[model samples]
Structure formats: structure tokens, C-alpha cells
Target: MASRRRLFILLAILALVVGIDTLERPLANPDEGRYSEISREMAASGDWITPRLNGLKYFEKPPLQYWATAVSFSLFGENEYTARFYTAFCGLLTLFATWFTMRRLTNNETALLATGVLLSSPYFMALGVIVTLDMGLTCWLTVALAGFLYAQSDGTSEPTRRRAMGVAWAGMALAVLSKGLIGIVFPAAAIFLHCLLHRDWTLLKRLAWGRGIAIFLAIAAPWFVMVSRANPEFAHFFFVHEHFERFLTTQHRRVEPAWYFVPILFFGVLPWMFTLPSVAAASWLAERERRSFPWRRFALLWAGFIFLFFSASGSKLPAYLLPVFPMLALVIGDWLARTEPRRIALYLLPVVVVIVIGLAIGWGAPERAKSAWTRDLYGTARPFIVAGGLVISLGIAGAAWLLRKGERVVPLAIVVLATLVFVDCVEDGYEMLSPRQSGRDAAAVTRQWVDPSTRIYSVNYYDQTFPFYLKREVTLVNYVDEFALGQASEPRRSLPTVAAFVEDWKRPGSAVAIMQPGLLEEVLKPAGLAMILIHADERRVVVRKP
Candidate 1:
């Protein structure tokens, strides 16, 4: 009972830390700003059916997260916290689901440890606070996996099995809503691979497909139906272009070597990466005795397959491998519960090496900066980076000493607290880089000069956070990068040429334009357009027609 109480307290503290950090940083573009603005527009426009960006139709991703965030905005009024609340909520919920699932599969000790592993993981915690579809997708995927495991686990009554399968189906449905087809595809493929390897055809027979399919369609189908009916172009764009082309081609411009996720998976788990071999061996050997179900093997298959899937994709990002981390936490948790402190102490050595490497990188970051402005920003951030590294190193050293003293539980606590501090420091440092990466400052300046009647033009580029910060859309001037589909459908929404934008700029009403400073000097100046510089930053220049 005391242990449970302590665990609950620790979790509550971690939750508070995560919640506070979500509000501390401005939204970083282009992903954070892009998603937040989409949600803001969704709330403002009251158009829940079709997702739009900058007041134009945007069907690049599904609308589940946008809906959740929109509802948050309506309740809290738009701000960084509200924009990120759903994602942070999902992250916490994912942690709870992981703990509950592991408790059902193994024991309370393993469950608690598993939850700790996930909470302390840098990548998992980082994504939880950042606005992105990845964490939302990871949350639902974890739920789906948990529900499936519960349904299949030994000693589950028939009624409980049916209900668990229902939960699994609903989770997949919500996953689809969160990020489209991969929600269903990943789980289905993992299950198939599991059954194929084990020759367990009976598990398939027990899946309750008739009821499951109904539940899945009931939750996932309405938005797809409504969006498709409202916009004819959604079907091909969402299904073929977004999923197929995104996976098979590099058209999204996110291509990387196939081994890209290899390092990500290694470092993403952090402090626990060294335990993988032991965890794998222990899980594999232990599952040999369980004839009823090989839960650990199934988890391994799930993580391995998904890692390989994203690694093989033509488009890749570090967050793409987030779904695998929950499964890893489970296996690693089980290993931690049974392993000795001496063996665990051995793992701390590699972590010290990582901390040293991190310090070196943090100190050298300013020197590697691309511009004088960014170099100054990096210089300002260097101390925070060093502080983060020092925090982790000291904690790891203390934890190692505790392990040598045969203390187990307190060492884990030290490490979790240390990692949280490290993450907090890194986030603080990241905010310092916001002057270059975010448009929040520019947006604030633009907000001072413009009213509802002012026409705003984004000439040649778009800073994703600007619209969210300003709470208004800018007209596009010869900018059709991600907005290509939106622009094609609504051609008049964007100005076609610089010459044409200059014509629009000559109109009588108050007008402001945002462009790179280089573009203003080389393009607009050469064209003899008269402008008053409103604000200029390292990344963007906001100007007004005079």
C-alpha cells in the first residue's frame, strides 16, 4: 500500500511537471504552429467537417486531433496550453494504458516500472508536450495494443474477452480518426504476423470480427463519409496521395536512409537502451513456458514490424517511431522487476557516455550555428544545455551508487526525476531558439499594426505559427508549397504572381505583407514596390504598403 501511494504521488508530480512545461514554451514551427493554427481555425470557423488551414481546405491529415484541440480552445480560449492540451492529455493517458495493460499481463511491480520507463523516456515525454499527430496516434495505438493483449491474456473470462476486443476495435477506430489508415493497418499487420509465426489460427477465430468491424466503422467512418461527401477530392487525396504516395515516394521531401530509425530507436528509449538485449533474452526465454499465449513475442513482433515499417517509408521523422516505445517500456519493465541491481548498474556506464557526448554537443552548438543571430541564440542556450547534461550525469551517478549499495527503488526515482529535469532544461533551451524558428515575435508585432480590415499577404513563404499567433489568415502570394492542393481547388485564394500581388498592394485599404528579408530586397525592391518595414527578424520580415 505504501509503495502504491508513493507511485501515485510520483505520477502526480510528473503530470504536474509535464503540464507546466506545456505552457512554458511558445509553439515551434512548422509542425507545432501548423497543427495549432488548424485547430484554432477549426474553433473559430465552427466548421468541424472539413479541416482548413489559413482559411483554405487542407486535407493533408485527418481531423480528429483538430477536433479535440478545437474543443479545448472553445473551453479554455486559444493559447499555447489549450493548443497542446489534447496531446499532453493523450500522452498521460497512454502512460496509464501502458501501466494497466502490463498489470493485467504481468504484475503490479512490472506495471509501475513500465510506466516509469515511458514517463522518463525523453522522446516520449517531448512528443507529449509538442503538438503533433504522432503522440495522438501513439496513444490510440497503445490503447489498441493494450486492449488486444487483455482480450488474449490467460484467465480472461469470455465476457471480459468480448469487451476487451470491443475496446481494441474502438481504439483502432480512434487511431484511424487520429491519423488515417495506419491506425488499422499497423495493428492488423502485427496481429497477422504474430499468428503466422505461432500458427495460432484459433486466436483469429476468437477476434469477434462481426462485432469488432461494426465498432470500428461506427467510430471511424462518420468523418470520412462527411468529409468525402463535402469535398469530392478528399478520397483520392487522403487514401492514395497521403498514404500511398507518402509511403512509397519521396515527394513529401522527408526522405532519409533506411537505417534512420536505427539510431532513433537506440537513443529514444534512453537510460534503458542498454537493457534491451537482456530484456529480449529474458522475455524470449520466459515465454517458452507459456503455451497459452506468447505475449512478449507478440510485443516484440509489434515493435519490430512498426520500426521497420517507418524505417522503410519514403517519408521519415524521429516521432514516427513513437508507437514502439510503449511496447518497449513493457518488456523493459518486466526485465527491470526481475533483474538484479548489479546488472542494472552495468547499464549506467553507457548512460554516462551518452551524457558526456550530449555535453560536448551542447557546448559546440553555438559554434555550429548557421548565422550570427542564431549563433547568439545558441550561445544563450548553451548554459541550459550544460545544466541539463549535468543534471542527468549527477543523477545517473547517484543511481549507480545506490545500486551498488543494493538499493533498487530509490535509484529508479532518482533517474526519473533527473530525466524530467533534463527534458525541462532542454525545452527551456529550445525556447531560446524560438526567435529564429517561430513567428510568435513577428506575429505580435504584426498584431499591433493590423485590424480586421487589414489585408495580409505572405509573399513567397509562410511561417506556420504566424497565423495562429495573429488569429487571422494571410493571403498567399505565389506560395503553393504544402498548399498546392488547396490552391488548385481555390485558385483565387492566392495571388498568382509578384506583379499581381504588387497590384493588390496598390489598393487603398490597409495592407501588410510577410516575406524573407532577402525576398524583399532582391524581388520586391527590384520591382520598385514601395514598402515600410514593420518588423524584421532573423527568419521573417513583416512589411506594410505605404
Candidate 2:
């Protein structure tokens, strides 16, 4: 009862930490603003089958997150909180799933520790609050992983095993819906590699393929069938362009070296970094004396294969490796449960060194700013950086002290609290950078001039946040980036040339165009386009037709 109470308290605290600021921060552009606007359009237009962004059909990925966020918008009304609610909700769900799965696989103590490890993971927790599909993907993948572990574990009845496998199938289906083929690919590859390594082909027979495939198809196939039927291009674009080309070629322009995720993994799993080597060693050694299933080896294979998979991919982003963290947390949590406090304390020393270095860098951040605008932004963020460093430093110190006193769980709790504080402070600091990173402020100012009939043209550049904040789409003028495919499909929606936009501007009753300051000075001004500068920022300029 006491253990359960402790778990409840921990969850409640983590929930508050993760969710308290969802509404307070502005949506950052390119990802948050992009996804939010997609959902908003879906909700307003009442078209859930075909996902569109800025009134253009966007078939780059699946629509599960858009559907979830659209539902959130319907329930809560369109706002920052609603926009991000799905991602944050998925993050919280992943936490609970980790706790539940680990408890079944190991014990209550390890379960609690695993949850803490996952929550305090900077990369994982940071992405949880941000509006992105990766967290949703991570959530469903975690569920699938947890279900697989539970299904394969010893002492499970036939019915329970079937149910667990069903959960796994459902999770993979949702994961596929959340992102793309990587959902099914990751799990299938991990399972195949695990079986090949151990020479255990019997586990494949026990996967309950008949019922599992039915559950998977029931969940994941409907959207594909419906969307492909509606738009014939979706199947080729999503499956081939998004999944295959995205992985095999650098068409997305997100190319990076193979060792990219190594540093991300090192820093991402902070406070637990020092323990990974030993934990991995222990998990590998434990595999030799395995029982019905070598779950430890399975987990290690899961993490290793994913890390290598993304590393080898043509396109790589930091958030792409999120699925690996839960398995890592499980192994680390199991190690933490068995390891002595003294050894854990030793592992924390390097974290203190890293924190101090971080503090020094934070203090000097504004000084290193390239421009006055950025300097002000860095200046605003510096205090929060210092506060976060101090909070984590104190937590680490207290945890070390508690370890010295032979207290185990309380130290982990202290670290979790400290890490949450640190993460919160960093989030607050990042929010301070929103003015430059987002179009929220610019949109707020631009909203007074915009109405249903006012033509808004985006010239030379696109601010992803404008459509969502202004509650209307902007016409693109002589610019096509990620919207290239959309532009090609709907050529009437975008102005193809500056001369065409100028002609439209001449005939326009009330119109405004947003572009970079350089575009305003170098292009529009030189072209003798008569415009009144309504608003200007370091990154953009909002000009109204005179």
C-alpha cells in the first residue's frame, strides 16, 4: 500500500511538472506551429481523412496525431494547450506504461525507478512538452514494447498472453499511425534479430499472428485505405517518399553523420550516463543464464538496433531515437534496483562536473551571442539557465548526501524532483526565446489587420505559425520549400512570381505580405512596390499594401 502511495505521489508530481506550462508557452515554428495548424485546419474544415496544412494537402506522414489534436481542439477550443495536449498526454501515458510494464517484468521498486529515469531524461522529457509527432510515436512504441515484454514473460496464462499480444499489435498499429513504417519496422526487426541471435525460433510461433494481424489491420489499415482512395498520391508519397526515400536518401535535407546520435544519447540520458556502461555489461552477462525468454538481451538488441538504424538513415533528427530511451530506462532501472548506493553516488560525480561546466557556459551565453537581438534573448534566458543548474546541482548534492546515509529510494526521488525543476526552468528559458523562434507575437500584431477577406501573402519565406495564430491561411508568393509538393498540386493557391504577386497587390482591396527584412529591402523596395511597413522584427517584416 505504501509503495503504491509513493508511486501515485511520484506520478502526480511528474504530471504537474510536465503539464503546468503547456498553455503558457508560444508554439515554436516549423514543428509545433506546423503540426498545430494542421490539426486546427482539420478541426475547422471537418476533414479528418485528408490532412492539410495551410489549405494544402500534406501527405508527408500519417494523421493519427492530427486526429488526436483535432479532437483536443474540439474539446478544449483551439489554443496552445490544446495544440500540445496530445503530445503531452502521450508523454504521460508513456510514463505510466513504463511503470506498469516494468512492475510486471521486475518489481515495484524497479518500476518506480524506471519511471523516474524516463521522466528525468532531458531529451525525452523536453520533447514531451513540445508539439511533435515523435512523442506520440514514442508513446505507442513504448506501449508495444511493454506489451511484448509482458506477453513473453514467464508465469502468464494463455488468455493473458493473448491479451498482451493484442495490446502489442494495437500499439504497433497506433505507432504506425503516429509516424510511418518505422513503427512496424523497428519492432519487427528487433524481434527477428533477437530470435536469430538466440537461435530461438519458437517465440515466433507464439506471437499469435492470426489475431494479432487482425488487430493491427483493424487499427492501422482504415486511414491508409480511406486516404489512399481519396487521394491516389498518398500511398506513393507516404510509403515511398516518406518512408523509403526519407530513410535511404537525404531528400529531406536532414543529413547527418553516422555518429550523430552518440552525443545525443550521451547527453540525453543525463544523470544516468555514467551507469550505462555497467548496466549494459550487466544486461549482456545476465543473458547467458536466461530462462524461458532472454528479455534482457531482447531489450539490449532493441536499443542497439534502433540506435544503429537511425544512425545509418539518410535523414536523422535528435527526436528520432526517442523509442530507445524506454528500454534503456528499464535496464538502468533494474541495475539501480540491485546496485549499491555507494556505486550510484560515484556515478553521479561526473554529472556534477557536467552541470558546473553547463553553468559556466550559461553564464557566458549572452556574451557569445552574434547579434544584439540574440544577445537580448540570451540575456533573458541566462537567469533561468543559472536557476536550472543550481536546482539540479542542489539535487545532486542532496542525493549524494542521502546515498552516504544509505538511503536508496529517497535519493532517486530527490534527483527526479531536481531534474524536473531543471527541465521546467529550461522550458521557461526556451519560452523566452519564442519571440525570435515563433511568429506568435508577430501574428498577434498582424491579427488586428487581418479578417476573413484580407489576402495575406507570404513572400520569399513562410512563417509556419502565422496561419494558426491568424486563424487563416496565407498565399505563398515566389516561395516553395516544404510546400513544394503542395504548390505543384495546387498551383492556383500560390503566386508563382513577384510580378504576379505585384499584380495581385495592385488589384487587392486590403492585403498584407510577410517576408524577411532582406527581401523587403533588397527585392520589394528595389522593385518599387509601394508598401507600408506595419511590423518588423529581426527575422521578418509584415508589410501592408498602401
Candidate 3:
């Protein structure tokens, strides 16, 4: 009863952390804006078949995330909280999924500990509320992984095994729909690697491949077939260009060092990092004492594959490492559930030292920035840092005292609460970065001047946040990144170059173009065009012709 109560309290705390201040800040550029804008269009147009962005057929990603966000918009009425609600829900889903899986593998204490570890991880919590497709993909991936792990155990009844395998297949399908081929590729590789390591050929036959494949095709195929049929170009662009080319070439210009994910894995799993090495080692050794299935080995293979896969990819992003975190949390959670409280406190000392150093470095950051906006952003962020640091320091002190008093769960609670404080601070400090990075304020200023007849053009550069905030599509003028294929098929709405846009500028009335500040002063200003600067910011400028 006490355990259940503690679990409920932890969940309630998570709900508060994920839900509060969701609308306190504007969406960040590129990823957040791009995704939220796509969902905005998806809901507004009521076109579930084709996923469009900036009023173009956007096939860069599958429509599952958009579908979720669109539904949230329908139920809640479009706003930042609504746009971000699904992602936060997915985060909660991941925690529950991890806890349930851990319970199946171990016990209630381990399950709760795993859930807390995941909930406390800074990157995991931050990504949960941010508007992005990664969380949805990560959640489904967690489902598939947990189900597979549960299925692999022979101690379960035949019915349970069958159900677990069914879940694995369904998860793989949803994952495919959520991202791409990787949904299937990642799990398949992990399963194959595990089977090879254990030399367990019988595991393959146990997977109920016939029923599973039917389930997979049923859930994952219809959209692909329909979208491909509607747009003949989707197959090649989505499969070859996005999947193959993105993996094989640096043409996307997202190249990073080969060891990029090394730090991501190390720091992304914070507070728990100090004990992970010892815990992971001890857990593996303990598993070897029994003749049970190699679940630990399978988890390592799962996380290791994701790390190695993205590490080898030509393009890399930090969030690509998200799928690996759940596995790490499970491992650490199991270890934490078994270890002594006082020893756990000893393991946390490194985290305290790191936090102190990070705060010191942050305190000096404002002086290093060149611009007033950047210095102010740093200055504004300092309070949140200090507040977070103070909360964590006190929490650590409390946790250590509780551990000395032999109060096991209280220490864990203190650590989790401290992590939540840091998460809140980060979320709150996000507003400081808004002016330079977000199009929210600029869009508000632009909205005052724009009317139904006013044509908006994104010239040379596109601020992803603009369309979502303005709640309308802006014409792209020589500015298609992933939209190139869409633009190629329908060139009517887009101008091919700045020269072409200048020519089109003479024929328009109340046409406002959003462009980079550099482009505005360099090209449009020298042209002596009758362009009136309507809205200006560090990153973008909105200009009108009088």
C-alpha cells in the first residue's frame, strides 16, 4: 500500500512538472516550429491523408506525430499547451512502460526506481514537453522493446508470450509509422544481435512471425501505400533520399564528430551516472548466477545498437540518443533498488561537484556574449540556474541525511524532486532564448499588419515558427530546404530566386516577406525597392512594399 501511494505521488509530481509552464514560452526554432506548424496545418486543413507544411506536401516525415498533435488541437483548441500535450503524454507513457517492464523483470521496488530514474533524467524530461516527433517515436520504441523483453522469458504462459509478441509487432508498426524504416530496423537488429549472442535460434520461431507480420502490415502499410499512390514522388524521396541518403551522405550538412554521442550518452543520463557503471557491472554478474534469459544482455544490445547506429550515421542530432535512455534507466533502477542508501549517497557526490562547476561557468557566461540581446538572455537565465542549483544542493544534502538515517525511499524522492526543479528551471529559462530564436513576437507584430488579402512571403530564409504563429501559410521565395521536392512538383507558389522575388514585388499589394536581416540590407536595400521595414529582429526581418 505504501509503495502504491509513493508511486502515485511520483506520478502526480511528474504530471505537474510536464504540464506546468508549457505555454510560458514560445516554441524554439527549426524542430519545434517546424513540427508545431505542420500539426497546425494538419488540423486546419482536415486533410489526414497528406501532411503539408507551409502549404506544401511535406513528405520528410510520416504523419503519426502530426496526427496526435492534430487530435490534441481538435480536443483542446490549438495553443502551445495543446500542441505540446501529446509529447508530454508520450513522456508519461515511456515512464509507465518502463515501470511495467521492470516489474515483469524484477519487482515493484525496482519498477518504481526505474520509473523515477527515467522521470529524473534531464534530457528525457526536457524532450517530453518540447514539440517534436522524437518523443512519440521513443515511446513506441519503448513499447516494442519492453514487449519483446517480456516475451523472451519462458516462465510466462503461452497466452502471455503470444500477447507480448503481438505487442512487439504492433509497436514496430507504430514505430515505422512514427519515423521510418528505422522503427523496424532498430528492433530487428537488436533482436538478431541478442539471438546471435545467446545462440538461441528457437527465439526466432517463438516470435509468432506469421501473425506478427500480418499485424505489422495492417497497421503500417495503408498510409505508406495511400500516400505513395497520391504522390508518385513520395516513395523515392522518403525512402531513398530521406532514409538512405541521409544515412550514407553528409549532404544534409548535419555532420558531427564520430564520437558525438559519447558525451550525449554520458551527460544525458545525469545524477544516475555515477552509480551506473558499478550498477551495470553488478547486475550483469548477478544475472549470470541464474539460468534465466539474458535480459540484461538484450538491453545492452538494444541501447548499444541505437548508439552505434546513430554514431555511424552521416547526420547526427542529440535527440537521436533518446531511445537508448529507457534501457539505461532500467539497468540503473534495478541496481538502485538493490543497493544500500548510504552507498548511493556516496555515489552522488560527483553529481554535486559537476553541478557546482556548471553553475560557476554559467555565472561567467553573460560577459562572454557580444550582443545586448545575448547578454540579457544569459542574465535572465542566471536566476533559474541559481534557483536550480540551490534546490539541488539542498536536496542532495537532505538525501544524504536521510540515507544516513536509513530512510531508503526518501533519498530517492529528494533526488527526483531536485531533478524536477532543474527541469522546471530549464523550461522557464527557455523564455530568455525566445526573442532571438522564436518567431512568436515577430509573428504577433506581423499579424497586426496582415489581413486575408495580404500575401506573406518567406524570402531566402524561412522561420519555421512563423506559419504556426500566424496560423497561415507563407509563400516560399527561393527558400525550400526539405521542401525542394514539394516545390519542384508545384512551382506556382514559390519564386525561384531573390531576383525573381524582386520582380514579383512590383506587382503586389500589402505583400510582406520574412527574410534574414543580412539579406534585407544587402540585396533589397541596395535595390532601392520601396520595401518598408515592418518587423525586425536579430535573426529575421519582416518587410512590406508601400
Candidate 4:
């Protein structure tokens, strides 16, 4: 493919991704919901210095996501679309940057294949729509990878390679600021491993150590220094707890089996998952001389290192493996350039089962999770969801047939991938994120009774999603206030436990408490806590004491 045609194809892929990804409502999962809301609060408060979680100075991850969302809040005035703005943009850049890099590494054929695989990947498309740190870190980190490849590609001389390495190093630093040390950590390890495997120490020595270190410090230091200085407690918790503790401990207890990423890599890269084997094989086969084969070993190391690296850690989540996505694209791109026509059908045959499984799961997700209300949220377009499922299933099968026939399916493949990722994952899965709460619906129930200054509490039960929707600080009595205190740090910094809630219970008849049903019987009954009907769900019970 010529440069213009390749550029056109890239643009086509970008359009498809952005369009499909735009379908999701800002379904605030516990984390994204809470994070976006906190960022908004900080932006509102004009306190950009101390990073607040819930309302506390949460010294957890670095503050870039919050800062990025805050900036989005500035332009669009704080909604789901605005909160997700930066992530979506980063997601596009990550996709395209991989394309450009892969093209330079091998050829346009490989680049197109990788872009197709990326366009279809579920994790990348799903996380791309939400307000999260994964996309931002992935973009800059992928950009750095691309820069390194540009540095190593055959004709680049020593000085130019050095400059490219400097660019890569600086990219790593910005990525570090975006997420944390893992930004640079995984890449550094992968590059070292790549060198070891290939016995090429030339690239390692090319980095202008003094100048590169200075550039990195210059790009990433400002935020860390300023934010740490203001928060005071950021260094220990961010470095010690967020990085070291999160990787090693069961504190979050999110451990998954060794094969956790297997299905994710399998399904998360759907539609293209069918093509991945060919893509990867081609990538490996492309290997030649040490420096001549840019896509060969480096791509594998980047993908495997990050995937296995996180897998070896104690805590695990689907989004943690995002950094490896571009490398996966790189490998698949290389594979595609070398894939034979006869082999395409082999990849397509098994996907009939995969799409069937995806349909059942995607269809059941809404019914089981009871996110049916979102259909109304989307108005008349609600029925389109059912259509979307069928469209996706049929689309996958249809696309597979195209790939099997060795038809030039760059466009058809693009559409199917985007639909599977955005429609099935984000559009339908948004409901499972935050349970429907009376607190979220408080305006409807408490509209008449609620004064601007009315006292409110999410007693005995703390759903971080509630206060975010309610747009005010609601106290918690005798529950997990750590998460709540993490969000809202001021006014009610200290929360009482059950014993303390018992001691502090007053029949003053002026407060409302939301508790789980079982807890209500024990905590309120003895105190003769009067009740006003507010809201009740399987998990939470709301009682306004009179």
C-alpha cells in the first residue's frame, strides 16, 4: 500500500473506533464514577493541589487522570462524555501510534493487520470509553515504544538513534507521571530482555545517559514535586502502597489464576482474535538480522513481559494489562503481512463458537445485571441494543467469512471490532458498574423534603456511587467509611464504627440514615430510631429517623 492509501485506511479505522466507543453512557463503575466525581469536586473547589478521593487527600495513584478529567470538566461542564473525553482521545492516539510505528518497523501490510487487531480488541475499546488511567498510560507508553523502534529501524544512524532513544526515554517519563512507576518499569524490563535474547547491546548504549536523564526529570518531575509537596503523605503511599504493596499483597484480594489473561487476550481482542494466530506467526517469521527485524523479538517481549509481569503480581484486574496492547498489535501486524490465504479460513472456523458465546454473554449481561433502565436513558434508541447484539454476532461471522476468503476486509474487519468492543462491553456493561441507589435517585424521592442544607447520611452502607450522583457529602454511620473518607475528606473526617454509632445515636429526630436491612434491625431498633420510607434495595435500606 502506498503512503496515502495507508493514511486513508488509518483514518477510516480511527473513525470507526471513535464512533462505536461513543455509544457508552458514563456508567460510573465504582472507580471511574468515584474518580470523575472527585475530580469535578476538586475543580469546583479550586484545590488542584491536594488530590482528594471521596473527599480525603487520597495518596493513591498519581493525579493525572483526575487532572485530565478536571480539564475535560472545564470544556464540557462535567458529564459522562466529558469525563471520558481524555481517555477516548488517548485511546485513538494509542491505536494510530501503533499503526505508524508498526509500518516503520516492517511494512504497511503489517501495520494494517495490527490496526485491525487493535480496532477489534475488547479491553482497548472498552477502557477507551471510560474515565480511567489505563488509556493515558497506554498511549504515551506506546508512543515511547514507537519512538524506540524508529530509533532502531535499519537506516537510522547512531546520532539519530540516540535522539530517538532520548524521545523514547522522555516518553517513558511522561508515562510514569500519567500512571506511576509501572509506566517505565515494564518497558525497561522488556527492552532489557529483548537485548538479552538478541545479544544486541547497541541500542542500550545509544541513550545519552546524562542528557536523557535530565530530559526525563524535566518532563515528569514538576507534577510529582508540586503534588507531593502539597499533599505531604503522597510519596510513601504512592510509591510504597500503590506500587509495591499493590503488586505483592492480597490487600485488594483481586488475585486471579495464572491463565487470567488468557481469556482476556483471547476475547478482549475479539473478531481480530480469530486473526491473531496468523498475525503473531507472521511477526515471528519476519525476524532476520539483529537490527533488521524490528517487529520480531521486541514485539513479543513487550507483549509477554507486560502480560506475564502483571500476572506474576498479587493483585489483578482486566485493565492492568492495557500497556501490552500496542505490542500485541505490533506482533499481529507483522503476522498479517506474512499470512497465507489458505491459513485465513483456519482462523475463521472456530469463531462461529466464539461469537455464539459472546452473544449469550452479551445478551444476558443486561438482564442479569438489571441495567434495563439505561435503555430509557438512551430514549428511542433503546431497542437498538438488542439490534446491536445481533448486529455484532452477525457482523463477526460475516467478517470472519470475509477474512477466510482472503477478501481485502480492512474496512469490514474495522466495523466488527468496534461494535463488539463498544456495544457489548461499554454500552451494555455500564449497568453493572454502580448499583441503582436511592441516593442517586434522591432528587426524585427527596425533592420535596430536601433542603439545600438538609442533613444526609448513607448509614451502615457506603456506596461511593451514591454521593457522586447526589452531588453532596452524605455521612456514613458504622460502615466502611474508608472509601467514603477517601472521597470526601472535609467536615466529617472521622467516622464512628458500630460501637461508636451506638454511642452517638440520638433520637433528635432530625437525621436520615441509610443502612443495610439487617444492620437497621440491630442498630436502630434499640435506640427506638423512627423511620421514614426513603429507599430500599436488596443490598441497601434507607430510613429517615423521626
Q: Could you give candidate 4's per-residue lDDT for residues 1-546 as a string of tens digits?
A: 575466556655655565455634544546666777778877877887777655566666666777888888887786667777778888888878888887776677667767766766666777777667888899989888887888878888878878887888888987887889987887788778877877878757766778778888898888889877876666877888888988888787798888888888877766556666656665665665443745567777788888888888888988888887778877765565566644655665576576666656655444444445643343333345556555666665666566666755453454445465445544553444334522355433544455665666666666655555556656666555335435343536535666555444453435555667777776567766556767665556666645
Worst 10 residues of 4 by lDDT: 429-438
lDDT value, candidate 2, whole model: 0.87
Residue range 279-303, candidate 2, lDDT tens digits: 9999888779676677778888989
lDDT of 3: 0.84
Model 2 segments more than 4 A misplaced: 1-4, 7-11
TM-score of 3: 0.96
Q: Tell me the whole-model lDDT of each prediction, alpha carbons only.
A: 0.88, 0.87, 0.84, 0.67
* lDDT, candidate 2, at 168: 95
The alpha-carbon RMSD values of the candidates against the true structure, listed in the order shown, are 1.3, 1.3, 1.7, 4.2
Kindly indicate the candidate among 2 and 4 with the higher TM-score. 2
lDDT per residue (tens digit) for residues 281-341 in model 1: 8887887766678888888888988988998899998889999999999888888888888
Error of 1 at 96 (Å): 0.2
Every model's TM-score: 0.98, 0.98, 0.96, 0.86
Global CA lDDT computed for model 1: 0.88
Instruction: Flag regions of model 4 displaced more than 4 Å.
Output: 1-26, 157-163, 274-282, 291-293, 358-389, 410-439, 442-452, 480-492, 499-512, 541-546
